[model samples]
Target chain A: AQSVAQPEDQVNVAEGNPLTVKCTYSVSGNPYLFWYVQYPNRGLQFLLKYITGDNLVKGSYGFEAEFNKSQTSFHLKKPSALVSDSALYFCALIKAAGNKLTFGGGTRVLVKP
Target chain B: DVKVTQSSRYLVKRTGEKVFLECVQDMDHENMFWYRQDPGLGLRLIYFSYDVKMKEKGDIPEGYSVSREKKERFSLILESASTNQTSMYLCASSSHGWSEKLFFGSGTQLSVL
Candidate 1:
């Protein structure tokens, strides 16, 4: 079965500093990776996806994710963090020809102003 | 913009009571999904429907059922509400393709006492 792993439970960063959330995947064949953000009392919003293209995929809210095939990692990154950027981040993936998408445990990002 | 709307924002139910969580999407998505979000468990897929009247069991489908009579709507049913079932329920929709990203509703926080 395909699965995703988010190592960090929470990440704290100062405003304007770079933010990174790590993710790794275990699946057979190629993988379709995605990043989503959920605000307080809100559903998740799609940030970006990596299907088959450039290794680096850019997403909404100035966020970006890098997909590495060899390492089986898709890490989300933001060059400058904002207080409003603090939210729960999730990394999900679907294996090639798979019907279901699997999600990781998630990581909470706290941007302090 | 794609919009997925869940009927309730919060709900409280007693044990053994049947609970219903409704979801509707404005877009004519071919796939709809129901997932439960817990504190550490990011999102666990409960059920999904690929077409009207066609439902599939997800990873955690025990004690849960689904109804998809219309393409635009999908409902998750809890046969008997239990305290362990108390969690945030999220509904999402996506196009037919496997690489497509999902659009999620605001989610319904269901508390089973």
Candidate 2:
């Protein structure tokens, strides 16, 4: 089974500062990794995904992720954080040939102004 | 713009009552999924459908059942509502194959009393 692990329960950063949320995955074959963000009382929004090719994948809202095969990691990054960027983030991986994704326990990000 | 719509944004149901959550997607994607979001648990897939009338059980499928009668509609059924089942339910759809970026509905906040 493919699974994702998010080591941190919460991440705090000041506005305009860079932020990073760590994610690691275990899968049998080539992994398809994804990042999603959820705001309070709202559904998840797709941030980005890493399938193949480039190591640095970019997504919505100035967010990006780096896929590291050696580390089995896909860490989300933003050069500058906004208070509006604060939300619960999740990392997911889809096992090869499976139709379902296994998600991490999620990390809450809080940006302070 | 593609859209996934849940039948209700908020629902309050009594114990022992049959609960039904409906999801519809306009994108005509080949896959649909139902998931529950709880604090510290992220999103656990309850059920997913890759084709109409084809369903697969997910991680947490004990207390839930799902139906996909049409390509664009999927429904989650709770035989008996329980307090522990109270959580934010999300519906998502994605195209088949690799690089599938899921599109999610606004979610339904369900409360069982």
Candidate 3:
């Protein structure tokens, strides 16, 4: 079965600081990885995805993720995070031939001002 | 912009009551999914439908069922509401490819008393 994991339950960082949310996955074949963000009362918004292209995938709101094949990890990164960046982040993945997308436990990011 | 709309933003119900959560997508996507979000547990897929009147059981589908009578609408039903079932419910729609990103609704916060 394909599964994703977000090791950190919560990550705290100050505004304008570099923020990173870690994610890793386990799948049989090639994986299609994605990142999503959710505000307090809103649904998840797509952040970025890694299908089979460049290792570094840039996404919305100045966020990017690095897909490390050897490490089996896709960690989200923001060089400078704003206070509004505080939200819940999820990492999801789908196997090359699968129809369902499996999501990680999730990581809560708190960007203090 | 793609819009996936959930019928309710918040709902409060009592135990043993049958609850219905509605979702509709403006985009003519082929896949619609229902997931529940809990703190530290991320999003767990409850059910999904790929076509009208076709439904698939997701990871957690013990106490839930889904209906997709129309191409643009999907409904989730709780056989009997329970406290454990209280959580944030999210609805999403995506096209018919494994690499397609999902568009989500704002979500419904359901509280069972």
Candidate 4:
């Protein structure tokens, strides 16, 4: 079955510093990877996705993700973290058959000033 | 903007009672999904529907059933609510493309006693 792994349960970053949330996925054939963010008591919002083409994909809120086929990773990154950037991040992958999305265990990012 | 609306934001039910979670999408999306969110575990897909009346079981669909009588509406039903089933339920919708991003509504926090 297609699955995703989020290695870090929590990441503490000082404000204005760079932040990285790690993700890896297991799937047959080329994977359709995605990143999502959820605030407290809210549903998830789409961050970005890696379907094809360039390795680096940029999305809303100045966030970007790098897709590395060799490493089997799609890590979410932000150049400078802010207090508002703190939230729960999730990595997901669509199975090759294209029916559903399998999500990882989630990473919580805490940006403190 | 694409809008997915879940009928309830919070629910409390007794064990052995039937529970219903309703969702509707305004963009007329071809696909709708139901997912449960817990603390450590990310989003676990319970059911998904590709089109009207074409539903498919997801990774964790054992105790849940779905109804998609209209293209814009999708409902998740729990025949016998249990304590273990209490969690945050999220509804999402997207186009038919596998790589398309999903738009989510505010989740329903269901508590079964």
The number of clashing residue pairs in each candidate reads 0, 0, 0, 0
Residues A8-30, candidate 1: write the lDDT tens digits. Answer: 99999999999999999999889
DockQ of 3: 0.87
Which structure is stronger by lDDT: 3 or 4? 3
| DockQ list for all candidates | 0.87, 0.73, 0.87, 0.81
lDDT for residue B5 in candidate 2, whole number 0-100 = 97
Note the residue pairs that clash in candidate 4.
Answer: none
- Candidate 1 per-residue lDDT over residues B67-99, each given as its tens digit: 999999999999999999999999999999878
lDDT of 1: 0.95
Off by over 4 Å in 1: none
* Weakest 10 consecutive residues of candidate 4 chain A by summed lDDT: A94-103
Compute the lDDT for candidate 2. 0.93
The top-ranked prediction according to DockQ is 1
Q: Give the least accurate 10-residue stretch of model 2 chain B, judged by summed lDDT.
A: B94-103
For residue A5, give model 4's deviation from the true position in Å. 0.5
Q: Report every candidate's CA lDDT.
A: 0.95, 0.93, 0.95, 0.94
Fnat of each prediction, in sequence: 0.82, 0.73, 0.82, 0.86
Residue-wise C-alpha lDDT for candidate 3, range B13-111, written one tens digit per residue: 999999999999998999999999988888999999999999999999999999999999999999999999999999999999879999999999999
Q: Which tens-of-lDDT digit does each residue in A16-50 have in candidate 3?
A: 99999999999999999999999988899999999
Candidate 2: Cα lDDT at B90: 95
Error of 3 at A20 (Å): 0.8
lDDT of model 3 at residue B87? 97
Task: Look at candidate 2 and tell me the lDDT of residue A113.
Answer: 100
Error of model 4, residue A54, in angstroms: 0.5
